[model samples]
Target: MTIPSVKTILYATSLSNHTRGVFQHAIDLANVYQAKLIMLHVLKPLSDSNIMAIQSYLSEKDIQKIQNVANQETKNTMKQRLADFYQDEMAGKNLPEIEQIVVKGLSRYAIVEQANKLNADIIVMGSHNKFGRSSATTRKVIKHSGRAVFVVPTDG
Candidate 1:
């Protein structure tokens, strides 16, 4: 029997308060296995109606600017969270090599796509209990992702 090796870890986050615990778990695994950690946040696309409404009020240039601003905001939030997480959870510890990215798409599809693109050996994420069951995204990722997944139980 051969054991699987984890060289790269994909940590998908919704950036909720409870995600800190899940992030810690991913960091722990990365540290133990000396794996590079990739932090991913998926931004859901705007609904067609919402897009039409915005288009009605804004020019193409203005819409592009709005999108640019939104993307920048998401990037800033991801950076701030990483800074805080490192300060609180990894103070003085040798932090693992971490790469952060934010992409727009459905959560499950984006996560699975990223795992494949990054060639991640494992996917780590939090599963919120909703009516005594895991979130749909969590369930779908596990079902669709061919890589190993480490799901931490989190509050809804």
Candidate 2:
């Protein structure tokens, strides 16, 4: 079998254990095809109503403090996770340009938008095998993505 020349690969992850498998796949493909690897994590935005409801339960100062703490923790966690993944799995390998991106938005939409912006040749994503029905997000990505998507089964 011939491997396609993957110039750029986008790996969308939710920081799940399953996503680690997706990352591994992306790394292997990147090494094989000499493709740039882009790691993307999307954070869902809290709605105004949701924020208001949470704020109502606490003093303004307390709410601000909590929000600041949460934001800082999230940033730290993401940075550490990305660094660990790279060091443990991707380091010492002749790989293409590797970039990590963290964006706040809906996961699937954010991934599709980034893929388009980057002109990615392939997207590697992990999927759970309980296939009763596809999620709205999954359907949307399948419909809208111009690039090919390689779904790695989480359970497999």
RMSD of each: 1.8, 4.0
At residue 33, what lDDT does model 2 achieve? Answer: 83
What would the per-residue lDDT of candidate 2 be over residues 117-143, giving only the tens digit for each residue?
999999887765234233455556767
Clashing residue pairs in candidate 2, if any? none
- Candidate lDDT values, in order: 0.90, 0.76
Error of 2 at 89 (Å): 4.3
Candidate 1 accuracy as lDDT: 0.90
In order, how many clashes per candidate?
A: 0, 0
Residue 7 error for model 1, in Å? Answer: 1.3
Of candidate 2, the 10-residue stretch with the lowest lDDT total is 128-137
Per-prediction TM-score to the true structure, in the order listed: 0.93, 0.73
Off by over 4 Å in 2: 1-5, 54-75, 86-92, 129-136
